[model samples]
Target: MIGFYGDIVFETSNSRILTFSELQRSTASRWAKHEVIGKKPTSEFIGPDLDTVSFTVNLNGQYGVHPRDEMNRWLIKARSGTAETFVIGNKRIGVDKWVVKSVSQMWGVILNKGEVVTGKVDIELEEYVERL
Candidate 1:
């Protein structure tokens, strides 16, 4: 199984699309390995300003047993390809973001401390940027 974390962008050309990434060398390395070698390594290269798709949790209040207003944000962009999802850890909660966590021909989903509830690929995007 192989997975990477970064922002994906896609461009349309003649009814076709091209994908690009703004990821770190480490994530890029892992992606390359999976693309070329067909195997997953143990670790990945970590760098600065790595734009990988991740979930941000806002821990405002509430503690012990039940929490209060836990909102998860998904940072998605254009150009990202298909991905897979998985469930990790002990907590079980409905996921709003596309979850792809593992090493396979499919994209892997990442969990905070390996705590996943449910996951799936959500590929839907609209043009958000224009250059004139």
Candidate 2:
């Protein structure tokens, strides 16, 4: 089945559960410390920071409910720092409290009535943690 942001999911299966049409994820995040180096070498390497994971899911073809509703609400929610649970197939634990970073909506075919007959939604998710 597809995935969901917050409480929304795109059901692709004809049976019930929605699956992902296409999913792309960014590599693991790294930590770095920066300091002014006027004289000697800058040595402030304490430890690494929290990891951040990014995912882009494509909503296309006949699968699950149209994700237009969530996409609409995401615009407003993104500003409010809305955190949500993210699950893509077998999701790993501690990979919770996610938030929408950006969205790109592509209209493939539009009708004469100015309605999109075929389109795809690309959602970007970021992992958010409270503390380091």
Per-residue lDDT for 31-100 in model 2, tens only?
A: 4556666865455655544434444444433444344543455566667778877765557425557777
Provide the lDDT at 61 for model 1: 20
Taken over the whole model, the C-alpha lDDT of each candidate is 0.26, 0.56
The runs of at least 3 residues in candidate 1 whose Cα sits more than 4 Å from the true structure, single-residue gaps closed, are: 1-114
- In lDDT terms, which candidate is top? 2
Each candidate's number of clashing pairs is 21, 10
Shift of residue 117 alpha carbon in model 1, Å? 5.5
- Predicted structure 1: lDDT: 0.26
Residues 26-61, candidate 1: write the lDDT tens digits.
212222222436665545444322222323221212
How close to the true structure is residue 50 of candidate 2, measured as C-alpha lDDT?
A: 43
